[model samples]
Target: MMNKLYIGNLSPAVTAEDLRQLFGDRKLPLAGQVLLKSGYAFVDYPDQNWAIRAIETLSGKVELHGKIMEVDYSVSKKLRSRRIQIRNIPPHLQWEVLDGLLAQYGTVENVEQVNTDTETAVVNVTYATREEAKIAIEKLSGHQFENYSFKISYIPDEEFVGAIIGKEGLTIKNITKQTQSRVDIHRKENSGAAEKPVTIHATPEGTSEACRMILEIMQKEADETKLAEEIPLKILAHNGLVGRLIGKEGRNLKKIEHETGTKITISSLQDLSIYNPERTITVKGTVEACASAEIEIMKKLREAFENDMLAVNQQANLIPGLNLSALGIFSTGLSVLPPPAGPRGAPPAPPYHPFATHSGYFSSLYPPHQFSPFPHHHSYPEQEIVNLFIPTQAVGAIIGKKGAHIKQLARFAGASIKIAPAEGPDVSERMVIITGPPEAQFKAQGRIFGKLKEENFFNPKEEVKLEAHIRVPSSTAGRVIGKGGKTVNELQNLTSAEVIVPRDQTPDENEEVIVRIIGHFFASQTAQRKIREIVQQVKQQEQKYPQGVASQRSK
Candidate 1:
C-alpha cells in the first residue's frame, strides 16, 4: 500500500509546484503527482520513513503565507472487518476521502458514504476494522463534530501509537523491513489536543518501544537551540534575574537553549513579564537541562533585580525626583563608575624625583652628578677605551712609508704618538701608541686603522729551511781563512744575519756555508730576499778551477 499523506490549511498563495519542489530538494522521489484541492493536497512517498520524518519535523509549523499546516495519512480503499458509522460528513468530502484516511493503519477493504436526498447532501460513512479503522475513528473524533465528525465504537491506547511506530520507524521497519508493513505518520496541527490521536498499524507486534525512542528524539531535536555567551555573569540579571542569561543584546533565550541542550523560544510578552509583572523567566530544555539554566538565570536576575529595586526605593526616600532638589544630592549623593585598567596592567610610572640639593655629593641612575672637585690625581676616566693592535708590517705603513703619516695623524686628533723601529736584525721592532681623550684617540685610531687595513701591507710568507753546500779547493781554504779568520770576520760584518761554515777535514762535504734569517714574518722574508741577492752575486764573482788557485773577476 502506498504511504499517502494529506496536507491541509495551506496558504492560498501555495501552489502544487511549491510542494513538489520541497520534496524534490530533499531527494524524495514523488510516488505520484500532488493532488491539490482547494486548501489541501495529498502527497504519496516511496516509503514510510520519509513520511514520518516529514511529519516529525514540519508538523504544526506555519508556511506559505503564514498558514498553519496539517498533515495526516490518506483514507484507505479497502473494506474493514469492524468500524463505527460516522455520518454527517462534509458535503464537499467524498468516499475517496474516507478511503485515504483509514488506509494508513491496516488494509482498508471498504469505505461507503450514504447520502440523504436533501440538496445539501449530508451523509454517513462506514469503515472496516481490517483497515485498523479504529485509528481513523480516533483522529476524526474532534474533527467530525466540527468540519469532520467520527463515532468510534472501539478505542486504542494513545501511548500505543508511539509503540507501534518504533525508533525513527525501526519497530515498524523490523516487521515491515522484510515483509513490507509500511507505517506512515500523518500529523495534523491539532496533535497537542487529546482528541487528535496519531494512527499506527502494520505487523501485530508493530507497535513497540521503537516508536517511543524515535518520538522522544524528534521532540528533543525540535526543542534545542544554542548561542555563545559574553559579558560578565553579574550584570546579566535584570529585575532580579541573571542578566547574562538574557544574553548580550538579548540572546539569553539562546543561552538557555544551548545550556539545556534544548530549543526554547521566548515570547515578546514573556520578556516584558520578567520585569513588569510575574518576574519569572521561562526556560526550556531536557527536564534536567531546563532546571539548571533556570536556577542560574533566576539567581542572576534576582540579584540584579533586588539591587535595582533597592536603589530606586532609596532614591525615592532620600532624594525626590521632583520638587525642590537638594544641592546635597547633586554633590555628595553621586557614585562614580570605576576607571578602566591602565596599559599592560601596569600602574603609571612615578613623576621624576629630584634629589635634595647638596654641594658635597650626588648619586642616582638618572641625571648622574658632575665629577666632584678634589685634589688632582692620576686615574683613567670612566669611559670606553678601544685598544688597537697593528701588525709589524702595518707599522711601516702607519708611519707612512716614512714618518710623515704618524706626525699628521697625531696633530689631527690631539693625541701623543710613539712609533717603534721596523722589525729587522739591526732594528728593534716598532709600535705606535696613542693616548688621549676618547674622542681624540678614536679619531686618531680611525685614520691609522683605515689606512693600514686598506693598504693590506701584511703579506703571507712560507718558512723554508735551507742547507747550502760550498766546495772550495783545499789550497784556497787556508787563504780564505786568513790568519785567525780575519777574512771570515769581514764576512760577518758584511751580513747582519747569521752565517756558519764547517771548519775541519772531518766534514762530510768538501765545503758548505749555511745562513738563517730570523725576524718578523715580513722581516724574515725580506732578509731571505737580500741573502739570495748576495748569494747570487758571490756565485757570479767566484769561479771554480780544478786543482787551481782563486780566479780573477771576469767582466
Candidate 2:
C-alpha cells in the first residue's frame, strides 16, 4: 500500500502553496514536502488511510483553475515509464466511459487527460506493467469511438527500421498479416527528427506478436545483407556459343561443375535481344571454386573462338552484317549492336493522345473534337460546351443569393450557364449547362469545381468527378432549355458540347427543380457559363424599368 498520492492533470498554474492550503482545508496531516511539477505533483500523507481519504475526497471533485484534478498513488519510475499515450479521444466523452474501457485490459494505475483541444483530447494512461499498456494500445488504437478514430504510436530507435522493413517491404507485410496490425514506420526526413516513430494498431495478442515478429525480421535481414557482401561473382557470355560450352548431354558442363564445385546458371532466353544477343552467367561458391571455374570456362571459349574464325569464310552471310570483332569472336571483348531499324519506307506512327486513352469523364465529354482547345487555332476559336451533374445541396451556393453569384461567374468567365429543371421527384441530382469558347470554358468550370470543394460536398483527398448538377425554377426552364430545344441545341452548337433538360420534374422546397450537366472539365465550364448568362439576362429584364415606372407614377 503506497502512501504517496500522485495528483495528475494539475494546472500548470498550480503551486505548492495551493496544494498545502487544500490539505489544510481538509484538516489532513501532511508527512513531508509537496513536490510540484509541470501538469503533475506528488505529496505524501502520514499513512495509507490518510492517502485514501485524500484520494476519495479530492479526486475529480476539486477544480483548480477550471481543470479537474486526478488523484492516485505515486507509481514507481519502472511502472510509470511503461505507460502508453492514447490520442484523438472525443472531447464530449465522459471519463467513466474511458476508464471502464481501459480497465478491461489490466490494472490501470492512472488515466490522465494531458492535452485537451477544441476537437479532441490526448490521454496518458499508465498501467501496472508495460505489457498491459501495450495490450491497451493494440486493442484500442484505430478503434472508432463515436466520430473519432484512435491513433496510437510508439517511439523507436532510428536504426531499427531498416531491418524491420526488409527488402522491398516483404518483412513488414508479413508482420502486418501475421500480427493483424497496421504497422507504420515513420523515418526521419529533411525535418531532422532524432528518432523514428513506429505505430502499430492491433489487438492485445496481435500487438505482442507484431513486436516479436518485427525484431526477428530485422535481425534476419541485417545478417543476410552482411553475408551477401562476402562472396559473389557475375560473368557475361554470348548466346550463340553458350550451347557449345554447355556441351552434348552437358558432359563438358558436368566436368567443370564437379571440379569447381560451383553452382552455375545462364540467364533466361528472354534476356537475349538483337542489340546484345548475350546472357549473364552467375556463379556462386567459395572463392577457390569460383577462381578454378573461371579458368576452365576461358579455355573452352578460346577454342570455340578459333574454330569460329576458321569457318567465317565458309559462311559469309551466316549472320547478316555480323562483326566478329564486335561479337568478341576474336580474343578481344564484346560490343553492343545498334537497334534494328524498321523495313524501308514505313509510315511514321501517329502521336499519342492522352484524353483518348482515359475512360469515364474525359472520354464521354471531350471525345476527339476537330478543334483543339489549346493554342494554334486555325479559325474563330471553336465554341466548346460541357454538362455537369451538381448535387442538389450545392445548387444554392452556385446560384448564390438571387442569382448574383451565377451572374458574376458568367461575366468573369465570359460563358453562358443555365440550370435545367429536375428530371423527377426521385432524382437526387440536377443538370447544369455551360457553353463558351475554350478559355471561358476553363474559367467557368474551374470555379464550379472550387465551389464544390469549398462547400465540402466531398473530401479534398477524393477525386472530383467532372459531372455536376443544379436546380432552376420550372418557369425559367423554358428560356434556358429553349423552344423545340432550339435554344439548347444552339447552346450546344455554340459551345460544341452536350446539353440535356429532362422532361417533367417535381418542384423542390423553393418550387425550383434539378438540372443535369455532363461533360469534360472545360466543356462543362463553358456550358455552365453560357447558361448563367441567359439566366442573368432574364433577371435583369424582370427587375429593369420597374423602378423607373414607379418613379414616373410618383411624379
Candidate 3:
C-alpha cells in the first residue's frame, strides 16, 4: 500500500524534473526524490490521496517528452484498486450530497466510511471502473462541502492483507532502513490484521526495493513453515518418567507450559506398541521456547533413564563380569559389551534394537546414507564427519599442483576434504575435515594415512594409524564406556582399534561429547559401528523390564 507511483514508458530524454513538472501541473506534490530508471521513473507522495489523484489524472493519459507514459500505483510494490479517497468532510455533509457530487463524474460503486481523529468524516469511494475513478479525482479536487474542503487522495487497493508484518513491526522497519524508505504501517485506516498494508514513503526506487525485501522475508517465512512441518519437534523420552512429567492431574505439564511458553503433549499410552517402546513428547512453540522446554523435558527423562540404569546396575552379573561404569570409548565409535549371558550359551539374540531393524543400532542411528548397489560390501552407514590431523609439512603434498590432488581425492572418495587453517605458524598438526558416509570417510582417511606414510612422516616399519573424532549425545557417553570400562575394552578386542573418551570433558552446545578413535581403517570403522549400535540400543530400549523397578520407586 505504498504511496509510491510507477511512471513507466518514459521517453529516454525525460528527466526527474520533467516528470515532477507533469505531476506539478495537476497540483500533485512530489513528497520525495523521483527514482528515475532506464525507461521509467518512480515518484513518491506523502499523501496516498495525491498518489491516487496522479494515477487517476495521468496513468496512460499524459505525455512526457513525446512519450505517453504509464502512471499509476507501483503495481509490483503496492496494492492497487479503482478507488478515490475524499477526506475532511464536515459531519453534517449528507451521504446523498456526496453521492451526487461523485456521480457527476463516474459510476459510484461503494463508499466506505472510516473513523477519524478529527471531527471531519473520511469516506473512501470506490467506482465501478478505473476510468470513472480517474474522472472523479478531477471533478472532486478542492470542491467545497459545507465548512470543509474535500481533502482528496488515492486509496490503494491491492491484496497484501493477512500477511505477518513481523514480530514487532521490525520487519517493516528493517525494509525501510535497508532500502532508504519510510513505511507507514500503523495508520489506523490500514489496520486490518497482522498483514497491515504498508506504504513506504521514500524515493520511488527505495519503495520498490523495500517491496522486494518484504517479498524475500515472506518467501523465507514460507520455506521455514514448510520445513517446520516436515521436521517437527519430536522428543523421544522414556515412558516411566512421563507420569512425573505430567505430575498429579497434569500439574507438572501446566508448570512446564507456564515456565517455557510452550504447549506440551505426550504420546498416548494406548498407542504404545512393542516395536516403539519410547514415548514421544511433542512440544510446540517458538524455536527459543521449544528449546527451553526441551531442556526441562530432557532433564526429567535423563533422571528416569539413570534411575532405571541404577536398578539394573544393582543386580550384578546382569552382563557377567562387566561393571557398567567402566565402559568407555573404543576404535571409531563402537560400543562393545558382551551381551548378557543368555540362557547357557544360546548366543546373543542378534542385538535387536527397538528403533533399528537394520544391522542393529550402530548402522541405523549415525548413518544417513544408503549403500550404493554393492551387495558384498558394507551398506551405506550414514554420513560422517571425521577431523583427521595430519603433519603441517605434508599439507603442500596433499594439496599439490594447484589443488589438483585434493580435488581428485575428494571426487574419488565422494567426500568433502579440506585442510583447516593453521592455528599458528609452528603448529605440529593441522586438521583435515573429511565429510562423507562411512565408506567415504574410510577411503578418504585411508588415503590421508597412506599419504603421510609415503611422505615418510612416520617410521618405515610403523603401521599408519590416525585418530578420528565423532560426537555422540552426552547421554550415550556412559554407555560408550560401559560399567568399569568394559565396552571400550571389548570394542578394542573386537576391532583392534584404540578408542578413548576424554575424562572430565564437558559436552558441547549441542549436548554431545567427542569420542576419539585411534587406529587403522577397519579397526576404527568396526569400533564406531559398535559404539553407535550401543547408543541406538540405549536410546530405544524397551522399558518393560524397568517397569517393575520404575513402579516401585516412590514419587
Candidate 4:
C-alpha cells in the first residue's frame, strides 16, 4: 500500500480540487484522491521513493497563496503503532493491570512475571507480534521500570515457542479464545473438580494470550463457588418494663419478644435512627418488627422527597430571566392573561383587507380609526395619487405578516397608507399610496428613509458607473439616430444620454425596442435603497400616532 502524507497549513478558502491541481501541475504521481479534513488534507503517493523525493524537494519550498508551506516525511504506520504501545501503559501497575490495559490496543499474548531459579520476581513483560518482540528487545534494552529504577531487559525468545501450557485445563481454553489460537491442552488432574495444567499449542504470540484467557476464566469461576452466609438476626430490647402495651420499655418490648420467642431490638428515641423528621419508632427483629420498620421508613422517605422537590422548584422560579412574567419583549406589561370573553360580550374585529392601503402586521395593537360614513369623501385638494410600487417579495417582510408594519408606518408618517388589493391581473403589483396633509406625506417619506437607514438598506455616498443603451429597428434607426446621431430626436425625448446600437454589417434581425443597462452601478445599486425607503414610508403612514402606543422600526 502507498504511504499517506499529512498536509497542513491550508487556507480556509482552499478546496480539495485546488490541492490536486497544484500537485498534478508539479508532476507528482499522486496515487489516490486527496482526503480533506477541517484544517488539513492527506495525499498518498504510489511509492516510498516518490514520497521521499517530494519531501526533500518541496519541504519549506512550496508556496500557496503567498504563504510558504511546511512539509516533512510522514511517520511510517509501523512506527506510529509502536509509539502507541509505549505511551498508553497504565500507572502503579502490576502484570494483570498492564495486560488489561495493553489488551485494548492489540492482542497481548501473555503478560507473565518472570522469575529466576530461586523464585524471585524479576520483571513483568508483554508482546504484541512475534516480530514486534524482537523490535521491543532492541528498543527496550537497559530500560528502567520507573525514573532511575531497576534495569529491565526484553529478550526475544529464539524461534519463540509455539506452545505454552498453563497451570490448569481452564487456562488454555480462555487463551485460545482471546488470541484466536487453535491449541490443544493436555490435562493432568485427579478426581478432584479443580482444573489441571493446560497446554497451549499455537504461534509464539498466540500461545501466551491463549494461556492468559484460560487462567482468567478458571479464576473467575473459582471465586464464584467459594462463598459464605451472613448471621440470621440479633435483637436487643429495652430493660425491664414489659407492660406498657406492654407500654414501658423492656416490659412492653420484652413481652412481645417472649410471646413470639424471637429476639427484638428496641432503643430509646436518642438511640434509635429516628429524629423529629422520623419521629416514629419500631422494634426491629423477628419477622414482625422487620415488617413494621419497613412501614416507618417508607412514610418518612415520602415526606422528605416531596418537601425537597417543592423547595427546588421554588428556588428555580426566583431566578430573573427564567420567569416569563419578567420579560416585556412582545407582550404588554400584563401579568395574568384576561379570560376569554363570552359570545355576546366580545366585539368583532375590523375587517382584514390584504390589499387595503394601510393595513400592516402590527395594526391590531392600535385603536381603530372610524372611517367616514360617506363612501366617497375627499380630504385633500388636487387629489393627486402617487403610486409607489414595492417588489411583491418585499411586501410581506415590510408589512411584517400581520399589520404591525403598516401600523408602525402610519404612526411615524402622520398620514394614511392604503395598500391596493390583489386583483386578478395585478396580483404581482404591490402598490402603496399615501394620502393626508402634504406636510404629513413629506414627513412620512423622511421617516421611511430613516427606517431604511436603520435597516442598512442605503449607502448614499457609494459611487457606481452608469450607462444606458436604446435600440430601434434598422428601418427606424435612420429617424431615431438622425445624421451622425446628432439630432437624435427619440433619444433626446426619452433619456438624458445618447443611445447606441452597434452598426455591424449583420445586425440582430429580431428588431424590437431594446433598453440595455450597463456600467450604471450607482443607479442600479440604489434600486433596493429606494424601494426600502418607500416601504418604510408606507409602514409609518399605516401606524397610529395616538397616545400611549410605542412605534417600532424593523431592526
On TM-score, the leading prediction is 3
lDDT of each: 0.38, 0.54, 0.56, 0.35
490 Cα displacement, candidate 1 (Å): 99
Better of 2 and 3 by lDDT: 3
TM-score of structure candidate 4: 0.19
lDDT per residue as tens, model 3, 32-122: 5677767777665544455555765786688777888777544321222356667668888888887888889877867878554446777
Ordered list by TM-score, greatest first: 3, 2, 1, 4
Would you estimate the TM-scores of all the predictions?
0.19, 0.24, 0.31, 0.19
Winning candidate number (lDDT):
3
Better of 1 and 3 by TM-score: 3
* TM-score, model 2 to reference: 0.24
Tens digits of lDDT, candidate 4, 407-468:
77777656687677765654654666666553344334334333433332333221112232
Instruction: Show where candidate 2 strays beyond 4 Å.
Output: 1-373, 379-387, 396-427, 431-436, 446-555
Kindly report which residue stretches of model 1 are placed more than 4 angstroms away from their true locations once superposed: 1-247, 250-265, 268-286, 308-555
Error of 2 at 383 (Å): 7.5
